[model samples]
Target: MHLKLLYCTVLSLIYGLALGSPAISDSSALADLLESSDKFNDHSVVQAFVEELKAISHSSRNISKCDQCVARLAVGKSLALLRPDLVPPVFTQWCTETQYMSNSTCLSTFSRNTVKSSYTGTNFADMLTLMDPFGYDGQLYCCYKESACSKPKTPDVSLSHKWPAKQTKHKVAPVPSANDTFNVLHLSDFHIELDYTIGAEANCSASMCCTPHSKNTFANLTSHSHKDWNSYYDSHYEGNSLVKGSLIDVFKNDSIWSPATTFGHYECDAPEILINSSLDSIANFSSTNNIDFEFAIFTGDAVDHDELSLTSYEVTVNSEEAVFRDIKNKLGDVPVYSVLGNHDTFPYGELGQENHGFSNYFAWNAELMADLWEDYGWLGSDESQYARKHYTGFSVETSMGLKVISLNSNVWYKKNHYAYWNASQPDTFGQLDFLIDELVESESKDQRVWIIAHIPFSADALPLPAKLFAEVIERFSPYTIANIFFGHTHLDQFEILYSGPGGDAKTIENVVASSWISQAVTPWVENNPSWRYYSVDKKTFSIMNAYNYYTKLNETFTNNGSAPVWEFEYSSREGYNVTWPESAPLNATYWHKVASMVNESVEYNQVYENYAKRFSPYVPDCASTDDCALDYCYLTSFTVDQYDSCVENVKNNK
Candidate 1:
């Protein structure tokens, strides 16, 4: 077991003090005080400080939320100014020791450079300007990250007030004929780890493994007993630095607990070899099947989940460039539309909205993506410019009159601490508003729209944006909006947004729009690498069929450097073994029926679970569990409120 340090709790106490009380603003005085005397280390001084913090934490001071956040920012900025090197290490230590976040996650999230250069802004003070005192980020940092304060109440941004009123009678598109269909490839979450080493550790103590030096390979640390190791780490350093060896060190690859192979591992992202092979397979599948794909939509995440300590802006940019180039090279003449994933950013999941005044800091990513997409001929100059201005989110109408709207959904992601500020606002970046504008235009033109993004508008996102998105779907779906696509979950799943009162799958008429979430090319954690392509009705722009293809990861272990073979895993229309009209596209109504089958049929439930993870061995047995029941609810519920209501209703009925 890795040594779990308790000193992080003390740091949390300090953080609580900063949040609750007016923090010391005189940086020069504070720096001099810390440098001249070790007040933070002195027992008498530290105990007094902790007591003061406790009093502040307990006190009901009539301070505004903005003032509180400003004070907290002051403390953090002062500390960073005093010892820039120490600040990041302390934060990383708190994340790892206090939150039990994996070392890679901690490092990636709070690295020294990432701390000073990215996130809300180029510096902490700029971040303070955007924060609301009652912001969700502070609550997350203080209540969850520090465990020093109670979780704050989430501001209610209900859809009842925001949802647009239906104008005319809801007009549903006619069931399409298969004879007028075309193919569109949908690839997502290709977390291509460029530095993947075949024989590296597949099983490690960290959240992500299967890379060179994936674990702390120090013999002194690894060989010691758990008790002795904890004692050693505790006594030697005060959550400051390792005593002898660095966190990463060269080790015998063969000595790993589980050796990685040519394809990939369940615990790791895709290697370059695996990524190339998958792309090759797609080309071959297209050729052999006599299928001509009109275009491809890549829903982001080109970078790997490497340690933030091991990553740099240059590394992130280079990895993405390489991956995009590879895609262009392998899939010749295929115009691939793309979006930026949460992991695609340097610090990971830290993109800020334009109104937040931090977009310029994160604009390099959008700019680069725009350039790449334009260079590949997937986007025109004006479209690329629009994408660059909007953080790589843009709407482009296809030559065939189908409007494709790609969104930088990370603005609403929970992990982008940037989003936590002014949490009550739904369209902070005006991206959702942009979406509505595009949808309205598409509706007027009688052109169907498809929304593509990296993250789903699900519970993993901040509730307000999700609700707003759900409202958008409710108003425009089944008429203007054909479908939405996402890929961050890395699971083969779907989300149905319904309109009207009771948000449930009790009737098909309520089903408005459905998001088709494709499985990932990166296995990451306990999943077979997979991809999907949709057979669409040219006229309706609705999906006629959905095909999933996957490669067995474990088989590559014995192939001895031979490439893994990609094969068809399932089809939405035929694979479920559920009967539906042949003329109908696999729309929201069809999915609603499948959701019912998942609830009532045992075999179908098991099969659904299996296909979700591409038959990974670690697929959970949700067939007889509340998990299976939740799947029904998850498919039916769109926004946070609906999900909560559905879950409560299910439990109450039971």
Candidate 2:
């Protein structure tokens, strides 16, 4: 009896399936209603068919054709409800299919409707109909439309059917040799001022005012009073003064005025011009030497502290932009990178309050930000907002094998007014993490990386733990980073050497460029205002320090009217294919060469000559002269006269 009941249920489900029309009142009578409704081709029959299908779908869970019947009925009912104007040809066929008494006839009518409706130019619809028989399958439909159903045409004989399979061999281009040298004109501590007049007012100190030796020198001295004293002193008096005199009186001495005065001021906008001229010289030199630069990286203190106001920030940005624009114009399309210095942030005002207006200036300038982003893709939009004054981890692929990572060290230090000292900040920790991650990833890729930052990891900046620097080097040892470049300490010549945690100590050479704005007035008599140029050899993956390669000041304005000169000095590696000398301690010998070169250059020659005459009268006439015979005689007579005069003066005084 159970088997008989099961068979009856199956028969009832199959026979009870309704046609395309409105739902019936009783599901058990749906099949009968559909059959009866097919006799009429009027709107009422279509509605009745839809109703019968709906009733079967709702009541008969076991009905196999319930969904199909409902869909067909819904379409028929929709057609019946449509206005005459809205009725399409497909709707007419749907009505006929629902009204027909024969099931096979109704199915044939539906197929005909589909064929007539499938009006695509390509045979895609027909192919889809052959492949899917149900509804559209996305992948099959796409294949049919895009590829399978297209009419066959004569294929190109040269084009292979297994195009990707027949791999076209690509030649691996040669990695740039480390020995392939390029000249990098390294400049730092520019302290460029905008609105020099404003500085002239602020810095102009009546009690501090002293007599300037020359008109130009006096003007610069006066400008110093209005400008930030520290910047003025550092650039002009402290850095550039060649004469051995009191720091206060250095400005008063007319004889020292020529080289002692900082020529780049905001009032006349001389800094922009000087920067441009230096760049021009660098480009010309590079062109002559057949050297191509990887990039030009400015090592912080790019701008002078003019004021902390919004207007001052705007002026500073404009001045900085002008300098960059000139550099870009001269250098063509070479990549240029910059790191923040203490002054780049803001001037410390009365109390501990820092005027944060400069940070906003950096944020709004799209060109400045874009330049940094293009070099270092790691700068996210979010980070750009909070610490706009600092930028870290700018990575660029200079060649197939060479990568550069530029970091901003300013974020690692504390800004106390115009003074910057190494102080730990949360941002510094974040930066360290980011740097480590980048180095590890670069090592994994087996690419050569170079790290560039403004401040060196030296003990003088003691608040910055040395252990951190050591960890950084240790983490990236596997990557075979070529070299790191930095600038900040205004050492005429100094080097900070380091040893990685495990490996032999690598002498990461630090180049301290002489201030372009002003040479320190004390110590060295020679006015050596210069910058370092580096040459990278792509083939060897080595960097050569080409120091003092560009003229900072015009010949006519500096020394005794001689053309501005560059000092070139280099140190050969102790052994080939090694990053550093095995046994040699990281020493200042390399930096000494740079300083010596600047001292020997034409710019320093005049200052040296003047110094020798004033301090060492006994020194022979070593000055370049036409007649060698006359030069020696002049030196001997001058020496003899000085000795006799000294002895007689001593006797008379006694």
What local distance difference test score does each model get? 0.69, 0.37
Instruction: Supply candidate 2's per-residue lDDT for 201.
Output: 25
What local lDDT does model 2 show for residue 634? 18
Q: Which candidate is the best by TM-score?
A: 1
- For residues 1-654, what per-residue lDDT tens digits would candidate 2 score against the true structure? 233233323333443543222243233343343344446454654454444434443554454442443333333322222221112223333435445334433332232211122232111112222222122222222222223222222111221121122112111112343344555556665554443321122112221111121134244442223212211232321221222222233334332322223333112223433454456556666778777766666665555443232224455466556555655667666666555655453221100112322233223433365454443532345444333433433555564466666665644332221111112221223456556666656655656666676655431222222335434553343224445566554333233232332212222232211111111111111233345555555453444433443233323232332223443422223211224443322223343343343234543333333222222222233346421222111111111222233345545765
Model 2 TM-score, all chains together: 0.44
Instruction: Write the residue-wise lDDT of candidate 1 on 28-83 in tens digits.
Output: 33334445445555343233322332333234566543444333343443344334
Which parts of model 1 have CA positions greater than 4 angstroms off?
1-126, 135-165, 174-178, 216-254, 501-506, 623-629, 647-654
TM-score of each: 0.80, 0.44
Where does candidate 2 stray beyond 4 Å? 1-185, 195-270, 305-311, 347-362, 365-367, 371-393, 416-429, 459-462, 492-494, 497-527, 545-547, 550-555, 558-654
